[model samples]
Target chain A: MVKHCSVFRDKTELEQGVAKMAELRQRFKKVVLKDRTDYYNTELPSVLELGNMLDIAYSTLIGALAREESRGAHTRTDFPKRNDEKWMQHTLVTKKDDTFSLSYKDVSFTKYEPTERKY
Target chain B: MKIDLKIRRFNPTTKNGREPYYQAYSIEASEGMTVLEALMSIAAAQDPTLSFRRSCRSSICGSCAIKINGFTKLACSTQIIPEHEKAHEMVLEPIANHTVLKDLIVDFDPFWKKLDKVKPYLMPPETQPEGRTKEVHISEKDAEAIDHAQKCIMCGSCNSECNALEIEKKYLGPAALAKAWRFVGDVREEGGRKRLGRLSDDHGIWDCVRCVHCVEYCPKGVEPLTAIERLRSRAIQEGIKDNHGAKHVEAMVNSVKKVGRLDEAAMTFKTLGLLRSLGMIPFGLKMEMHGKMPHPHLFPQIKKIDEVRTIYAEIKRKNKNAKKKPKG
Candidate 1:
């Protein structure tokens, strides 16, 4: 998941990560805790956290796949230029009623406009 | 290479952890795999029940302090592969001098309490001049004094390995004392004398036995024993010398000053004073009976006593108005 959503990512990497994450979520249902006792029950919580991580990972992969431009850490080798015409917004992932949704909101430039980043 | 990890696990509800027993797990060793990675992998695949505390995987978090082969170390930094030995004989357990709440997790309440007693945070000045808010400008050299101390992530590694804490729980452990010195060494602080007075009380700064366990085992290289020594010297310099520790230090210095060697009898009397020295009469009689007591008058006079005084005079002249630099 990390390699797919790394510093240099593309459409194929995002799609592969999204598919692998879906498989991971399905497999995570069978995972069981060896220690079910309540005293410091990290075993149960850890499994749940892993499930949550898979969900987040899936959402991130989808968001990266949907956005077709290079921006910040989500730089793509295929789309190397920042596309302000179509992709100038914030990617927000939401979960409701057991379903995951990916959407974007327009960034408000109240103080400073988004200019070309220079070293 | 395959490595066998013997981890001491404890869970209040389980039979295997009723008395805290070791559980062995054999895992295929990979290059550059840390002990923390090995434990997490084992818990995920092999057992799914083994418990330990870890985070960051970097040394900054300081949450992975565990006993590995009788030494407290951060598991995230310690590699699973042995450097010299063929198979890394791994034994993981919780650090000592703390209440073991569960598997590899100790109760940090006592440790946090000690830190609170030391007042770790820098205090704001009592009065500020009208309308001119400015930064306390300290030189780079001045800030270098506490650079190592500032790197402490509160791992509790020093507190775990402290021998004084093993003997006397009331004694302020190394981490807290070092923290006390951090503020005391800062030139910006306004209350150095008051801080030293409080630290000089019972089970405080004077209680450290100079075991140097804190110095040797501190993972961050924060030599807390050196800080404790500095605090001791600062306490003496500020004239808070009524306690037994300061009196004993003074007695030794005075002996070294007057004669070329230590006058044991005079030093003892001065340090312990009348009432405490009277309690030592039985021990003195025993020493006398065994003919082991070296009488002060019987010792030969040294002709080179002037040389010792000259060295002392030079040191005094050099540090005529020194406050930060300790006197010997």
Candidate 2:
């Protein structure tokens, strides 16, 4: 008999996520209120905690970085342009040995291909 | 700009044996006027008998869902300015996968029946302390997961867009499965075993083709595809194996894991097992006749086997790590 583990195990990770979000809110509030934009620049343990809080943030960041286009929710202010050639495939982010890596997955092109992503 | 609103109209009383027809109503473009509002204006001014369902003009209540420009959307929520302009016309019709009642309304009996079959309710444990009431402590992370599940309003949008529903009407579509997962993930619910049993049947959980149309059409961020995947994983965990689907999935996964790619013939043979009397030979022969079965000799030949193995290993590792953490 092939044994499968519980999918409800994600509940635990969700708990850790909430604690991180609360901490980020506080950090963001303090920085904005004190007019200290360099608050994140300061070396602190909270930065690590914030990183842990935004666990899924790496996926979005990597996806944004990989795609030089502002399509859907993926927007890169730095690139300021859409590059369809290099980033036409869907950016898949999977955690490998406690580190997140990016992979490209093929997308089915039916009716529309990637064009200039106008709102 | 004048936009042609092609509305499907069907009056049960006046329209005898005639098929449903699309009546064009040209309306002036108004700022911030939703498709539902434009529909209401057409109904009020041009045709009062233009039948469609609408209660709350807001996205909530899940009513007023219709197909606009080949996509399922809440007419009340969708702004009709630019999207319709790009298309040059708006086609309003009832949600798919259900019987059309009249014009833009569909009979929701099938949707409700599937919802009821899943037994959408919390079945708490019998061992509760008497006279000592305590709030069920849910972490924010778990709460967020539940929050994702909670956003579903039983709108048949997901069902309408579900490819599984198109092929197999008996298969409980995404909305119902997501509801089942909502109950399954509830920490206070002690009926997980029963729930799993109910979903382990042929037309139940095992029937999802994973086409992911439900994931796209859902107005809320509820990914029913993920929920269904989670359910499948849970069902496997609980040792409840349906006839061939479970075995097929397992064989496919194992084949991919072992050889780093799918050995279609080997996977089929593994799934069929050594029992000749199990009626698998005929099935294999049929598939062979249909040219669906690949040759058995070319079993382990695949490009980038190591890369595939590495990807699978990484996914398994992440899943293992994710399970070890506590609920938020």
Candidate 3:
């Protein structure tokens, strides 16, 4: 989960991330609080923090999987070129259960026209 | 690398004043590990009860501002290694001038209340500038100034270090005044006059001591002290001079111009007039008794009074030139 990031990774690493997520889910049991009302009753990490990290990691990997173009920091060897016609807009992804759904929002341009990057 | 941490702990739900104490821990910190990450590591490994507010892990949330080595800063952005001074020990405490709710969490009620006073929102003009169909047009220059103030993340670093707020709890503090600048500097806001008027009142912009601590401590480089000063000058420019702060400053400037140095006696007379100046006699006598107010001889005539005047003139000219330039 910690090794997963969108930048400069290809299909193999992303697939490994998806599999890693499932493996972690199977290996790590959910923590239960001894006293629900007492914030300090738990062990080192409260269940809430682990839960947030699980959700964040899941969503991040899912978002990376849904994107197919190389734009900004998202470098995908599988989709080396930016498909501007289809991928010019933002990729909005949502996860329900294990399924990922995607949508797009148009980029609003003002004043200067979008130019090719040199750097 | 192994680093030592001394974290100040205060649990308001259980402890009171003087009960707060520091707890030491050792953590293995890697390269590029932030102070926030270090704290998280300690909490995850050594202590579950350790408390601090955090969100976004990134600096945007503005939740993890704490005093590290007596300076208020965002924990998320402050790298641990660069801050090491005493071998590997780092002292962490809740920010000053705010009530500590727990270990490192502070009650932000006062901070929020002060910000609420600024009406930190736009009150648009009744009629749009270009016409009904078009959105209000703010020249790039004006928008740039507003954008600078908009960088404030309300991290409370400025508030924690504000000397003015230390003395006057009611002083709007840096974050709120900077927020006020966003609205006052906005060309679309019709209530610029009204907003400036409120800020000109007591415990407002004038209350800031210009210590520049806010500017130094602001992570966003908002330069809140500069914003408060602009608010003061703007108020005077708008002919809203019903403030003692404005009067005191104008009197000081005029006095300096006339005498080539501060004529405190004359300045006070002009600032408060004869009656109010007379009312200050008791305080003046106390100062005299303490030998703090040595009898003043005419300050030796400045060697280059003309140069002083020329510098002032140059500043005025530069200000006029800046006003004439097209803002981007």
Candidate topping DockQ: 1
> Model 1: per-residue lDDT, tens digit, B143-196?
887766776778999999998899999988999999998998886776788889
Measured by TM-score, the strongest candidate is: 1
Tens digits of per-residue lDDT for model 3 on B1-328?
8988999976544534238989999999899999999998887778767888888788898999999988999999999998884335699999988988778888899999999999989998776555357665677777887776899888899999999888888889999999999899887778989888888888998888889999998888999987888788889878888767888888877766665788777677777878998999999999989976534365565677888888889998998998897432
Query: What tens digits encode model 2's per-residue C-alpha lDDT throughout B68-89?
Result: 9888999988889876877767
Docking class of 3: incorrect
Whose lDDT is greatest here?
1
Pick by TM-score: 2 or 3, better one: 3
Candidate 1 chain B — worst ten consecutive residues by lDDT sum? B319-328
Q: Comparing candidate 1 with candidate 2, which one achieves the higher TM-score?
A: 1
What tens-digit string does per-residue lDDT give for candidate 2 at A2-118?
011112212234344445544554565453221122222222333445455455554544444445554544444445555666666877888776556788988789997756756
Instruction: Please tell me which model should have the higher DockQ, number 1 or number 3.
Output: 1
- Evaluated against the true structure, the overall lDDT of model 3 is 0.81
Evaluated on CA atoms against the true complex, candidate 3 attains a DockQ of 0.16
TM-score of each: 0.91, 0.65, 0.76
| Error of model 2, residue B14, in angstroms | 2.7
Residue pairs in collision within model 2: A11-B327, A12-B326, A12-B327, A14-B141, A14-B328, A15-B327, A15-B328, B139-B328, B140-B328
